[model samples]
Target: MAMGMASSGRRRGNRTRRAAMAEINVTPLVDVMLVLLIIFMVTVTLPAVGVPIELPESRANPVEELPDQVNISVDNAGRIYLENDPVAPGGFADALATIRRNDGEQPVIVLRGDTGLDYGRVMAVMGELNRAGFKSISLVTDGSDTAP
Candidate 1:
């Protein structure tokens, strides 16, 4: 009987038993979530789409930015905008006059003209600004990489 029990124990030893895993391993899942989070964060900081315009490059020194400055943009389609707000072509002068009176002080005007726009269009806007009594006017352009 002892010899038979020893043989049964050997047979049982020959068969392997494995315990089933009860807990989930979340390390890979957490790593994937973190990578997705980083991708979103990087994309969020990129510039959003706005009025499409190609700016001409110039070797002129960059003008100092001021808090009391206003932007007047002209798109390639000849549409005029005041700080992203569309202004009617005929109402452009009136709008500037109103803004000038409300501010009480002459603010610097920054004109951003698209490269495809007519030269006369930009000059007309500038003339209107001058008529509105704004003396400080600056033309915005992309900086040239070449050394002056």
Candidate 2:
């Protein structure tokens, strides 16, 4: 009876060891899932939201070398200016055509509309750019504060 009791105790010890090890073994699985999640998050780039206006304040970090930028400004009155030169409403297409003729590579069109202008007006300009086949377009803003 003493020997039988000892053997049963040894079997219980082995079962306990196996039960402790069978805890789903989730540590390695969790590590792998976390790594894949990080990889996907890093690879994805979120689209820019809103009207691309009302840019927040930031310290100036001017690039030493940058490509030539074509400036397009829209005033509060909705007048469009192409690089300091006033462009008539009917002349926008012509101006864009000229730019394309000058440079086959699409010039980076920087749209700078007045803050007081309607949001729809800004979107209209973006639509025109898309129609004109301008692939690279950006919105420009002034970093100055008028509160003073």
Candidate 3:
């Protein structure tokens, strides 16, 4: 009987029990999340979406600064750019709405219209911005135009 019991124990030992991976190995997941977070942080700090435009110069002081004010620029070719991305003339209202949503309440817009662009064109863009709930609008220009 003892030998029989010993053989049964051996049989049970031979059939090893296996368990599902119930325990989550958060170490790898956490490592990947941290790496992605670092990559995003580094990219956000750089001005990768810079729009090429020649800002008109002015003698007046600027009330708005970088990263705080939104840029709505018009190039010499009369193309409109919102935050470094081009937008169609007909889609101006839609773009402004999106910008207004992202900028939260009472956001300031800095218009960077080229000196060569038509005045009416810039005003039309401003009107669209105003319609999209932007009450404050600024024109960016070089300080050289201002009185020394």
Candidate 4:
């Protein structure tokens, strides 16, 4: 009877069991999501856009003294002023030619465009200056104000 019981036990052991399956684990997925969240939190505090333009205050810094510069002011009306003298749009080329002739060393052209003026107008002035052979052009800003 003992030998018969042992034979039955051996037969049960001979039966094959199903193999364990290999599958993608989700532990690494959770870790990756946490790391990405930390990275975003650390870098999200920086300023995206620059400050806007406003009028200069009384406490603004004094203008630094530089060599003689040719002042060109563009008002809101799209009118051009050269050294406080009003210059017509048609006379721009002729006036620039005269300035070029008088300047011994390439004179610095300082452009002071009003905040209310159109940006295209400013660009047009720059284009005119470039065509007139004026290479040293400096944009004059109030420095007290930021662009809106």
For residue 72, model 3's alpha carbon misses the true position, in angstroms, by 1.0
Sort the predicted structures by TM-score, highest score first: 1, 3, 4, 2
* lDDT of all predictions: 0.79, 0.67, 0.74, 0.69
lDDT of 2 by residue, 1-148 (tens): 3555443233553363222344577899999999999999998854222233343343444222134767777887887777778888778877877774245677778777777788898888888888988988766544554543
Arranged by lDDT with the best first, the candidates are: 1, 3, 4, 2
Residue 48, candidate 4: alpha-carbon lDDT: 20
Better of 2 and 3 by lDDT: 3
For model 2, name the residue pairs that clash: none
What TM value does model 2 have? 0.51
Candidate 4: segments with Cα more than 4 A from true spot: 1-63, 100-103, 145-148
Task: Write the number of the candidate with greater TM-score, choosing between 1 and 2.
Answer: 1
Model 1 bad stretches (over 4 Å)? 1-50, 100-103
Segments in model 2 whose C-alpha atoms lie over 4 Å from true places: 1-67, 101-103, 144-148
Expressed as tens digits, the lDDT of each residue in 1-148 for candidate 4 is 3555433232346574454557879899999999999999997754221223232233345454345667777776777878767788788877778774344677878777767877798899999999988888767555445435
Angstrom error of the Cα, residue 124, model 3: value is 0.9
| Model 4, C-alpha of 130: deviation from truth (Å) | 0.4
Query: Model 4: what TM-score?
Result: 0.52
Better of 2 and 4 by lDDT: 4
